[model samples]
Target chain A: MDPDDLQAEPLSSGVPDLPPSDIGMSVEPATEAGAESDSSDTSSSSSMLEDDLLVLRRAWINERNSPELYTYEGAALENLMELVDFQLQSLDAQPASIQNDRVKYLVRSYLRTRLNKVEQHPGYVLREMKERLSQAELEYAEGFRSLQDAHVRKSFLDQFPAHLRRVDEETKDGLKMVPEPDMDRAVFCRVRTTVGQFQFDERYVSRQRRPAYLVQTTNMQCVVRTRSS
Target chain B: MLGDECFKLAKEAKDVTPDHIPAYNEELVRLVTQESRYLWRRVVELIQATESSSQQSSSGVFSPSQSTSKPDLSSQPFSNDPADVSRSMESENMQGQVALYVHTIERNKRCLMAYHRKRAEFLQSLLWAVHLAPTMVPQNVSQRLAPEEQNYAREYAKLNMKYRDSVEATLCPNDSLDWALNGEVPPRDLLIEVRVHRDCGEIVTQSGIVNLQAGTQHYLCRSDVEHLLTIGYLEHINPT
Candidate 1:
């Protein structure tokens, strides 16, 4: 009945365990049983249960209205908390029942239904919440890693080493060629920081057609040859 | 019906003047659209692997082109009559109708998937809401139901649970909601009863409290009454 009482309590710490029988005190016994005399008693009980349920429903609605990013686990916890609020509100909103026997029965139903759900699917909410939190952490780490890598760049020439070499050749047509390097070309390329390797070979045809140059290299690889424009 | 309509217009083309080309054009569009629909359905069947024959014919390869690439209608030679040729040409003009169908089906399938995903997300959220709500009990618990009503709910639950395997067969032949909607509407109020025991207390098995607020009339329109009735407050019936 009092919103203040609920709001005053620290909801984040989790809901306090409620006395089972006292949760829903508003449900009235069915009219058929005590139609003539106990109508008031029935109404009183029903009203109490209804009020508490209304409050619980409101709490659940509020929790659900959270931002788009809240995980299902958090949502589930919010739901459970609201449900407890609904039960408490139900007790205060409706008049207390005179029929203790009926009240007991109704309370037992509420507890059984709820507790069964909790037991049947134990720790489901907790697991979901933890998973969402972990996912958020992972995403954050990925973003941070990406940010850290902003300065990193692969050598532009590395992607197309052959193209870079061709440009250099076009700029300066003739370079010294020692037809066959007297020393191993590999050792020279490795030791000299500025030295880069280039490969070329000419296959001789029967002196009838233009000799085709066969060029290959580990320096650059292309899935398909791109013809220079 | 569209195909039939097109067929009628094509036959009457001889009687109408050349100016009545508009009528022929309209009929052509309808015919092509219908053909496209047929092609679309077949293509979808192949793509979804719903065609048993296609699945059995090939060990593992899935090629829609094998099933749908050739227009089945193409093989049906057009009548020698110039009028028939004209009509067929108009129908064919509707832009390789089968191609249009494939495009539309793909788009719709994507939309359906997105819609289902969003709906699932919403339902998940709703469940969470229900879980959190206050400790409230039902507003009313009916007194013991008359013996007859009790027996009815019990029998209904029993039938549903007992024949559950068969229920799938009986409920909808195609089992797909789309197919069910297109087919005959199933029966109303085919009730089933099953006895469910609770740890807290025993609900009267024979009788139930019906909340007038919750009724089958709406669900009956969208779903089979039998299917809807199979769920809810069955074991909670008040016994007389």
Candidate 2:
């Protein structure tokens, strides 16, 4: 599959999953409660569909690039999952299955990426962080920590000291014995704006090529192309 | 000397062959944990020594919560007081030692976590790698795993098998075929050219059973031959 085709979607970085309510209404004001009027209806609905896909793609890239767990794109994921699964039920050898397959692959990759990250530091993610994981992911993390704890007890108890066995124990100087993401790690990005005086970090940006000023307030329309190293 | 075992453990994990699991260094893990225990004991001793000095120097100045003492007060507060200087100096020395030991212990914990997590991930990916070939981790590979990892691998394989079967059933209940284990995205074309690198007796395709002879070429429907390409019976010869 040409990932570039779905590259219509923008990557997220703490970006909200869906466009804000006002931006959504402004994008397609008449289509919300409009009846089955054929001409304008199809066009509006297709455009809305395109917008939804863009948000989903953004979530995909954002999830891919972030060092730590980005915000869960819960709403976008729910909408895409329902739409693809519903389409896939009667999808008898149709070419459209290709697109559905792409969606499935993206969702699977996104979820798996998060799952791998969670596995790497289950204790840290569960105990130190908040709201970055979905409810399902949180439960899985809890289960994983307990499972590993039980496994460690069964395997390493005889040799390991009792006091040192606790992985999350803090030291006397208040240093936590847990893995943490390096927030200052360098990341690559394809920038189209001057990005002068970024609120997060001024040094992370410098150059610009083509500046397209966006007046809309939708966080889902992420203009930056993440090439995070 | 402080974190030498941990340093070696991380290096050993990285030095092994890329595609194989390394032997678990249980001895190094024990030594590191033991190091952490000793460091903690030393820190506790330092804290006690500093706490006693703080009490004696402060004289009649009563500290309510005497368990945890704070050296947070700057030199300006103690500059005018003569007795405070000696206590502050002693506390400063102990705090620095405690800080260094604490950082080393945390570093040791991270190294230990890195080693185990690396081995665990290798076990997880192995299940997927051996899916189309042999189902289970062969006896030789399983022997290399720690006891906990072996159990993890068994449980993970079972979970993957269940997930694959359910997904296949949901996708194509009547027709028995695969929904995954293909190219990342399904190829665009229906017909694809393939080269047979090895000799195989016969395999069924949509047209009919084709004799998969050695060094033969055929333009078969992609659906009929994609699985063969995956299993190394055939290779997809891209048209130039």
Question: Which structure among the candidates has the greatest TM-score?
Answer: 2
How many residue pairs of model 1 clash at the backbone? 38
- Chain B alone, candidate 2, TM-score of 0.65
Candidate 1 ranges beyond 4 A from true positions? A1-69, A72-229, B1-37, B41-99, B107-240
For residues B1-240, could you state the per-residue lDDT of candidate 2 as single tens digits? 778898998897785554877688878888887887789889888988888877776653454443235444555754434555666777888899998987787787767766776776777666655552324567788777777777777665554455445533443344433433442342354577889998877888756788989899998777666667766878888743
Off by over 4 Å in 2: A1-45, A78-97, A127-132, A172-175, A187-229, B1-7, B27-110, B131-135, B138-140, B157-191, B195-233
Model 1 residue A47 CA deviation (Å) reads 29
Model 1 Cα lDDT, one tens digit per residue, B1-240: 324433443344343332221112333433434454455565555445434533554532245754455444555563344544554454454435545555543332222222222222232222222231112111221122222222333332333233222322332233211211111111222133323322223222213322223222111111222222233322323211
Local accuracy of candidate 2 as per-residue lDDT tens digits, A54-79: 56565666556555666666666665
What's the CA error at residue B227 for candidate 1, in Å?
25
TM-score of model 1 relative to the true fold?
Answer: 0.17
Which 10-residue span in candidate 1 chain B carries the lowest summed lDDT? Answer: B176-185
| Tens-digit lDDT track of model 1 for A1-229 | 2222111100211222333233333233323233433455655544444564444432322222211112223232233333333333344433322332222222222222232222222233233333433232333323322221221111111122122222112112343211111211111011111112233244322211222222222211110111000
- What's the TM-score of every candidate structure? 0.17, 0.59
